[model samples]
Target: MVREIMEEGLLTSRYQLPPNETKPTSNGADGDGLTDNLNMPSQPAASSLTLVLVFCTFVAVCGSFSYGCSLGYSSPAETGIMEDLDLSLAEYSVFGSIITIGGMVGAILSGKIADLIGRKRAMWFSDVLCTVGWLAIAFAKNALWLDIGRLLIGLGVSIFCYVVPVYIAEIAPKSYRGSFASSNQLMTSSGFAIMFFVGTFISWRTLTMIGAIPCVVQIIGLFFIPESPRWLAKCGREKEFEASLKRLRGENSDISEEAAEIRDYIATLEQQTEASFLELFQRRYANALIVGVGLMLLQQLGGNSAVVYYTSRIFKESGISGSLGLQVLAVLQVPAATIGLLLMDRSGRRPLLLVSASGLCFSYFLQGLAFCFKELPNLKALTPPLALSSTLIAATAFTIGLGGIPWIIMSEIFPINVKAQAGSLVTLVNWSTAWIMTYSFNFMMDWSLAGTFFFFSGISGLTVLFVAKLVPETKERTLEEIQASITHFM
Candidate 1:
């Protein structure tokens, strides 16, 4: 059956059985008629290399979080900075929007670059861009320079966010893929958590400069990790792929079965080389693209960035004063997001998204009520701190539900052939929406905090409905399997 499937090109090579596997061997090798020439060494116990990869991912993702934190915290601080620099709100918003604009371009282009140059090269490029962007921001004497700096930083973030998950997904074994991929989100939230505190202590300019430090660590760490085996196979470097797999799986490990699996998967991909970005819109690919794009849009509309970018503003509107409110909100995000990350792999994608979305809806609804009732005869005495605390709780709920999962789902939804492009498209939508919310949030706040919460709540409520109806569960599937499944939806 397996042979028939392979020969028909219906089964991916990764799923193909060994030529003569009539019986299973003690080593989990099938004793099919085919010779097992490649003996995988005893699986190396988890090593420093694994730690190194995790750390690299952490550092790479920190760039993303730093960008988010800097953007979020910096926006409010701009009120003060604008006086010093002689800038208008619109000018400041435009400068902030430059990051998303750069991200949109980067997200669209980085996939093609990663596909051509490989993931490692892409990371190195990202680090260089990050360093340069931060330096520009740190020294900027004018609004134009600041916007230019943000644009560069946005470009770096655009590439890093898309590339890191793809690299981690491709490199991790199937068993650990969920946990490993979720690590990107964990680190991202951690970055947000750290930035809140950092922003609290330092001037926004200093905070922006501090964000550059992680990229240095990322550039150095890249040297220690092996190139992705899947990328190697995609580049038609079979020997290199074998060596990479050996290093990742361990030199003394038994990877013959694994190698065979990869070879077959690559063969299947090679057979379909005509697939292109436009093909992603064709009937065969459209379903996956829709899911990918919809989830991206849903994530933004769910109001995660609105809260992240404006938590301080939201609190101040509710009556909380000083930078301390921002600090408290930031501190809350760490544990809330940490809890969400811990549950991500175990809870599966679809369920958590649904639950989180629903929670967000309820939280936002409450926030709206809190706003509406702020001047109620009986509730007029409620302290600003208490109202802000309620808003923080709502923001926490928003982060867990929609903040991290969209990135995870986007990373998992596409096949290797179009993964980068599709991922970039989705991320582009994400950042663009982020820019819209970030730009308009102050206006919304000016209208009413209750009104803003209500707006976000409506968005979150819609997302819950859409995800429940349209999104597929992608918890434990391999990349090939995810592609196959999404193909059906399309």
Candidate 2:
């Protein structure tokens, strides 16, 4: 009987009722109370909700510190640490890549866990893993222990990244979705900036420990936020969903409109069969899977990871003295990322992606040219700073374009039936590519710096082409609409 009621309610609403359904007292006297309330937007009053979202975003995005510190501090300090530990470049690369490998494994596994246990719970699990990883790294005496610790931290970061955006998307209203979702990227940049600054002042061990601090706070914060309403509905927890919606939307606001939407979404999901990893290759979902994997792969191959992992080395190779140049580059990331957050909603996804890719490719090409002509008398004096600056520009552009988009698109592109599994598969690919790029870059640089920059430039150019040809613009589209479009492409 309950199932029949659910089906009837869902079909009547066509997967989401009009917001007007939330009229006070279920009467038309006030003419759709929820709609009237939503339309009556106030500036300073609305800012409170925005502030709450930003705080949640900050806590969720703190996961990036694990990735940022690992990339920034460890990449630059590897040579120094290797000298102390008597390790080879290959061994160091293996250790560095282990984190990505762990992330790949974790991302593949965490999605279903989040689906089953809820997004908030999954995040708490991540916090525990992050704390353990940091504690392990802090006290490590051998390279093996360091790798193990890194692997744990990577696992936490991967899970957190996968879950946070989904949670934000599920909770945010349609009007504010873009801004709220983009906050994840802003927080990631903040994490990177913090790590870079902290690494400059402290020992690598201390930096690692400090990076773990945010995860502790995140664990506490998770308890304060409501669980995702969509997840609650999926689990047949109608009462919980209704209560969560009220809290998220506010006490005075009616939730029937949003509740109806969740009911419809759940019903549509119920009509589909469960998805397996093998189904990712099936016709209905294959194109989306390809796009997801392609985006992840392109993001890494665009040279962001290489630049981030080797910022200090790149600066030193360019004949820039001391660590000051690296510090300046790190500081530059803050504003670049801020600009990205601002442009993301306004410029739309495809335009920003193409522009960012073009800029990245051009930056890499210029850096390659500078490296190639380092011996030229006239160019010699300016080669070092110019090359470093070009690389920084490339990194910033890539981060603005690809870093957050892949995660956001991956979370939304797949249908509800396959979302968890498909998102995990895409995230797995993302981490795997990160591992490959980070591991291969040192070897590529060893052969020739020019060769390395040229390789990445070629990849960035290819990414622009891919975006033009295959990737669809998803800005401001409903999840159902985006799914339908992808199905057509498939």
The most accurate candidate by lDDT is 2
Q: What's the lDDT for residue 270 in model 2?
A: 85
Q: How many angstroms is residue 102 displaced in model 2 relative to the true structure, after the best TM-score fit?
A: 1.1
Candidate No. with top TM-score? 2
Candidate 2 per-residue lDDT, tens place, 290-389, comes to: 8888988898877676677667777777888536775777787778778877887677677778988888888988888888878678778778877877
lDDT of each model, Cα atoms only? 0.70, 0.72
Off by over 4 Å in 2: 1-52, 83-91
Q: Mind giving the per-residue lDDT tens digits that candidate 1 earns over 274-296?
A: 45677566555676777778878
Question: After superposition, which runs of candidate 1 have C-alpha atoms over 4 Å from their true positions?
Answer: 1-49, 52-56, 375-377, 383-386
Whole-model alpha-carbon lDDT for candidate 2: 0.72
10 residues in a row with least lDDT, candidate 1: 29-38
Model 2 residue pairs with clashes: none
TM-scores of the models, in the order given: 0.86, 0.86
